[model samples]
Target: MANAKLNVLVAEVPEVIPLVQEAWRAHFALTFCTSLAEAETLLNKRFDVIVCGTHFAESKMFDLLRMAKSKPKSQAVPFLCIRVLDGELDGTAFQGISIATCALGAAGFVDLNRWRREYGFDQAREKLRQLVVSLAHQPT
Candidate 1:
């Protein structure tokens, strides 16, 4: 375990907080934020991963990624976007955003209901564990 405690900043709804926390607990030192400002504050420090939901008000996925790209500390950080809905994700949604120029590291679009049924908290934790291990081993 390179660092068992991975700093994770999540920007999602109040209801989703517990679920995300439960899901990622094994792999992350979870931090839940209802607002983008709070998320941004955490971003200013160190983070191994970021899990963002679709409903974040002030900043969306692209906005956060762009900010991450600009920051020297977070340039290689892995970003995961959690889409609650069951539709195709439009890459164009982030068009014209500065982060659009950079390839998004890794993302998993999961239907909230489906995730609960099939890949619940335990499964999510396993997935995150694998992801962290892989990222940690990658050459900079």
Candidate 2:
């Protein structure tokens, strides 16, 4: 299905729905789930990429990440974890979370506060585009 758009599942809070839709709808088929449980259920289906909010970190997000890594259909899929900060994102906090998720095998991360404040979501959009292209190029 080379002509079909990639599928991306975003497990994030309601506040960020519009932003995510704006950034990824044009390039991929977007599915939005507001909670970790919902995301876990959706995982039974196929998605080329999974984007999770920091709020999910305390929930089942990590379990889902592990599932993706182990499942044959999603073993090579990439996951991006985005964090929404209370105020300006502290460098240390950002690093800590990034390191944690990466250690758990996330493919990448995006700081929502940074994306909105500094880049108007351009960086986030680019990161997603990169994932889409990279996945497309991989041998099935």
Candidate 3:
């Protein structure tokens, strides 16, 4: 059989969908959702990565991170948070989740202008590609 594509669920504001989709296209089967419940449903369907926007309204980003981390099936899956500020990434976000990468932005938005102008999408795609490759080769 052919190799399976890595599954990724992106939980972010609707405005960031284009940028997130562009950045993740080549590496994984990316799906975007605007709500935590929707994201959870996607997870139930199976995903290797979960990328969340730090600006989610109902819960702090860390809370969603924790939810993903607590699931045994998703514990080894990577969880990434896109943020608008710089600070220490809380270890709690990775309490059970495997890898977490925080991509910085200027304000609350994803900064798509910089993404296009600076090849930020390319950079994200490369990083996500590496992560998927590593996961694929990991011992089961």
Candidate 4:
């Protein structure tokens, strides 16, 4: 399974530390694209999962999920959305994003800021690894 890494498409990658970025490359074979059009070009192939950023706007999350799930090759791929936190954050936006992504059939959502704040870097990395481990084995 280590050698047979999962293929993943990451749309609109966020700014993170090198370790977090490296962890993703180490754990999965990632294809990154900045726009939906670019992502669409890459979607001709199957991916085990699609990780997307909301681009600091809630609607972009919906757009990302919609595009990925609409494609024939990527229709069933497990889709995960990464959330961006604001400086003066409350729990309101957090809950809203979760419910929305859930309603739209996202496999999961990762709040890296929350994970790092609550669980530390080591634990956050492990959790991401565990998540990819589960999705990698999912029936395509």
Per TM-score, the best of the predicted structures is 4
TM-score of each: 0.65, 0.75, 0.60, 0.83
lDDT of 4 by residue, 1-140 (tens): 55887888777644532344677777777777766667778888778888777772333667868777787888888888775444423478778778888788788777777887889878977887788678757776
Task: Give the runs in model 2 whose Cα sits over 4 Å from its true position.
Answer: 57-60, 116-140
* Residue 60 CA displacement from its true place in model 2, Å: 4.9
Q: Name the better of 2 and 3 by TM-score.
A: 2
Score candidate 4 by TM-score against the native.
Answer: 0.83
Of 1 and 4, the candidate ranking higher by lDDT: 4
- Candidate 1: the clashing residue pairs are none
> Against the true structure, what is every candidate's RMSD?
4.8, 2.9, 7.5, 2.8
Instruction: List the candidate numbers ranked by TM-score, top first.
Output: 4, 2, 1, 3
lDDT of 1 by residue, 4-104 (tens): 67677776778778866676677668878777567677777777666666666544766766666667787677666665544434445533222443355
Judge candidate 1 at residue 107 and give its lDDT: 41
Q: What is the lDDT of residue 87 in candidate 1?
A: 48
Candidate 2 TM-score, C-alpha based: 0.75
Q: Rank the candidates by lDDT, best first.
A: 2, 4, 1, 3
- Model 3: per-residue Cα lDDT over 100-119, one tens digit each: 33322111223233343456
Clashing pairs in 3: none
Q: How many backbone clashes does candidate 1 have?
A: 0
Off by over 4 Å in 4: 14-20, 56-59, 84-89
